[model samples]
Target chain A: MIVDIHHLNFAYRDSEILKKIDFTVKPGELLAILGPNGVGKTTLLKCLNGMHRASAGTVMVEGVDILKMRPMEIATKIGYVSQKNEKARLTLFDAVLMGRKPHIRWRPSDRDLKIVEATIRHLHLQEMSLRFIDQLSGGELQKVCIARALVQEPKLLLLDEPTSALDLKNQVEIMLLLRHVVDYHHIGAIMTMHDLNKAMRYADSVLMLKDGKVFSHLHPSLVTEQMIESVYGLPVEIHNINGHPMIVPKDSTQNLCC
Target chain B: MHLHDGQIPEEYRKYIGRKFVFLLLLCVSLLIALLFSISSGAAHISLTDVVSSLIGLETSKKIEIIVWNIRLPQAISAMVAGAGLALSGAVMQSILRNPLGSPFTLGIAHAAAFGAALGVMVLGGGIMTSNSMGAVQITNPYLTTVAAFFFSIATAAVIVAIARMRGTTPEVMVLTGVALGSFFTAATMLLQFFANDVQLAAMVFWTFGDTARASWSELAVMSIVVTITGIYFFCNSWNYNAIDAGEETAKGLGVRVERVRAVGMLLASVLTATIIGFLGIIGFAGLVVPHIVRRIIGSDNRFLLPGSFIGGALMLLTSDTVARLILAPHVLPVSVLTAFIGAPVFLILILRGGRK
Candidate 1:
């Protein structure tokens, strides 16, 4: 398993955010965490990457408990991309090179530069490598963020709403890029997504969070309309189109929970 | 998304040539400023005379006293204070992510002033008459410096504490700093209200920030402190660059975000404290020089730090020379000329709206 979480619990002050969450991910698999706005999806992602401490559980990345590890130690093994994109003033090359901080000694080695160059090329950002990041568009900046994470060369990748700021075409392109990189690099990826259809199409498995608990954790093929409706508190129908699950929300008032 | 398919600038690719050229230019400019400052003083010493004296060629007795005893210490003190303040300003701006973040804006200057007042009251042997600048001469310079250093660090601690509680956002940090600065200013004013004439005169003179008071011994101590702190800042240049991207991103890149910020504040505070403790409050060097350097060379701290150091030295040395020569035989406070230049630049920064 590339990532293993057991009986994980988290709270902010007195109110609990995540409760008894348990899951495991294998290498080369893409796991999409799906939930409503306040269901603790982003918070859960923060916990797995050690940005937030788990209240009562353990997160193991590559068979080592992350709770016992320092932030720098966890960062070496798990690359994380945040939800909000900043207009960084660094050149794209330096921005990506920043990811090599954990590996750098006094200065960047030739090997480190080579890795950053390769990662930038892999992201198809060679043309803009010397440009300032603030000059890039939202989609380009998102790619830069991902490129920075990729340069870390982690065993597991965590992304929070990676496609939130993108348009539809950019969204699909980014998801495809993530899938391609995860497959080629053979690294496990866990991303929180708001688009249910995209998750159903691209993720190897789906984890649904509802009211700070796991509503359903299973393959996308096994997801049912009742499960979706139960978690979202809205009526929805699932249709199989070209071997992919697509959710269509039902228009009804009486079935809504009181 | 690229606007041009033009080849990346060769210098950009290598990361050595342009930066080297810029640094070289800054060094050359500093040397010119040093020579200009040393030669253009009231004594009317020729460049040859100044050069000979600097190289220990045994000039006349009057030339030696003017160049070695008075001018050299003042000129070098200006350079050291400029470099230290500008470097600290750049570091503070980066760590706080605020363009307005500097020793003055962060309350460190006012805090140091208050401490100086405390020092004057204690070391000047109580209520002093305002008639004489030398009447309240501090019995122990170290006492005043230590007091100033303590208060400056204390101010930084308060700002950091406020940041920690309210979140280390740029707005929060800047607001807390402004508030703390105002409070310290008010506190210093209260001290001045209660001060005797001599102590009041001493307090006022200390705040004028003249480089003439820097003796060789004091310069030696200031040099050691600046060197140690400057090297530490240079070594962590990459980490600072990472943090500039954003805190979460820096943490994701394996930087200890909170720890780095705290240490950065500590180092920057110490640098500002040591300089201000010796030279009094030299405002705007830290604030203005870094901004100018950032506009010219860009915001990469690796280049920005050295660039600010040299640029700052040049500005202060030039400004001090102007202050000395603008009126012969009597020197205006260096801070007067600095603020004359700095206030306008600060207003321009606000009007231009370039800073993020």
Candidate 2:
């Protein structure tokens, strides 16, 4: 396993955000966490990256305990791409180059630059490399962020709602990029996403999160209609399309709730 | 999408070249400003005589007093305050991730001012005059400046800590700083009310920022501090670039986010305190200089940081020169002139930012 979260419990102030959760991802596998809003998906990702410590359990990357390791050391092992806030205003290259910071001290070497350049190239971002992120479209920026993560050369990668504001084309592109990252880079990826269809299509494994704990952790093929209904808190219909699961609401309400 | 490619300019690619040039330029400019400032005061001393006095070749007692004893200190003080205040503001702006971050806006300057008032008005604050300029040896004005600066920094630290612990928004940072600054200003005013006539007058003028009383000895001490810190800060310029690059990105890159911000703030606060100790509360140098520099050199602190220092030194000197020469023998306080220049420009930024 590349990442191991054992009996995890996390809270913000007085309110508990995560509880007694056990999750793990094997090397080279793409694990997609599917859930409704406020279900602790992002929190779970933070735990794996050592951004937030688990109150009751432990998060281990590869064989090293995240709690015991220095944040810098953990950061080098598990690269995380997060939701971009307003403060980020640097150009794509400058932004991606920052990903090499964990490896180099005081200054970046020629080798670091080569690695960053290769990561950007691997994502086919040569055209948009010089552009500031804010100036780029959501899709382009998402790729830039992924490129930055890849520069870290980590065994594991974590992402939170990487396609939240993207258009349909972008949403598909980002998911495909993640799929490629897992297969080509042989990196273990754990992504939390709202789109069930996108998750089922790209994810080798799916983890259903409900009320701060993992409702189910299984292959995408094993998530039946009954399990989807139980986790989402609503009756949902499931369809198989080209060896992938398609989850939709039976209520024709258009928006699915879980 | 990228139009040109994100590759850094080859000139800036090697940190050594850009930073080295900036350091050399800042030193050269400081030297030139020092020379220009000595010659062009309210006094009618020729440029040639000013140079002669600076080199210690002049023997005329009156000319020596004018150049060495008076204008030289004033010039050096203005340079120190300009470089120190602007550098401090840039570092704070980068750390806090707010363009409006500065000692003046955050009320660090006011806290320093209040501490000065308290030292003078509340605790034997009057100048002891035996030498000219009513030498303030007994009062230890440096203590007041240092204390005020620290108080101001403490306030900022508390606010940042609270913001971090509570996960505060930018509006909260602004509101908190304003409230703290206003409270400190009011307290200083109350201190003034209880002060004796002479103490009150001294406190009032010092808070208003007059470099008229600057002496060579004081400026030398301040320059040493500014010089050391300036070199240290410019050395870590890339660390700042990493932070603004994005917090998660910085974190992923192994940049210690919390530690970086804390260390940056401490260094910036020290610069503020050093300037406040000697130059008094020179209004808006911190607030406006970086903003202006940002426009000229874009937002790369690698360039923007040192650029602001150079621009600030030139700017404050220009403003001080105008204040001195504009009225001849009847010189106006530099604080008022800085306000005159700073206010309208600050208003323009507000208007422009609003329009955009």
lDDT of 1 by residue, A1-258 (tens): 999999999999999999999999999999999999999999999899888889999999989998898777888898989887567567888888788788887877666777777777777888898888989988998999888888787899999998988999899989999998889889999999999999988899999999999888899989999998888888898888887788998868556655
**TM-score per candidate, chains pooled:** 0.92, 0.86
lDDT score of residue B288 within candidate 1: 89
Model 2, span A1-258: residue lDDT tens: 888888889988899998898878887799999888888888888878777777777887777888788877887888888886443445677677777767777777777776766677778876776666667877888888788778778899989888888999999899989988888878799999888888888899999988887889998878888887787777888977776678878875557443
> What are the lDDT scores of the predictions, listed in order?
0.84, 0.75
> On residues B170-260, what C-alpha lDDT tens digit does candidate 2 reach at each position?
4565566778889889999898888877787778767767676567777877788889889888877777776776666666556677777
The chain B TM-scores of all candidates, as shown, are 0.88, 0.81
lDDT of 1 at B185: 90
Q: State which docking tier applies to candidate 2.
A: acceptable
Candidate DockQ values, in order, are: 0.38, 0.32
Error of 2 at A169 (Å): 1.5
Residue pairs with colliding backbones in model 2 are A102-B253, A128-B2, A130-B5, A130-B6, A232-A258, B112-B148, B120-B125
Candidate 2 colliding pairs, count? 7
Q: Which stretches of candidate 2 lie over 4 Å from their true place?
A: A13-16, A87-89, A241-244, A252-258, B1-31, B43-68, B127-147, B160-174, B194-197, B227-232, B342-356
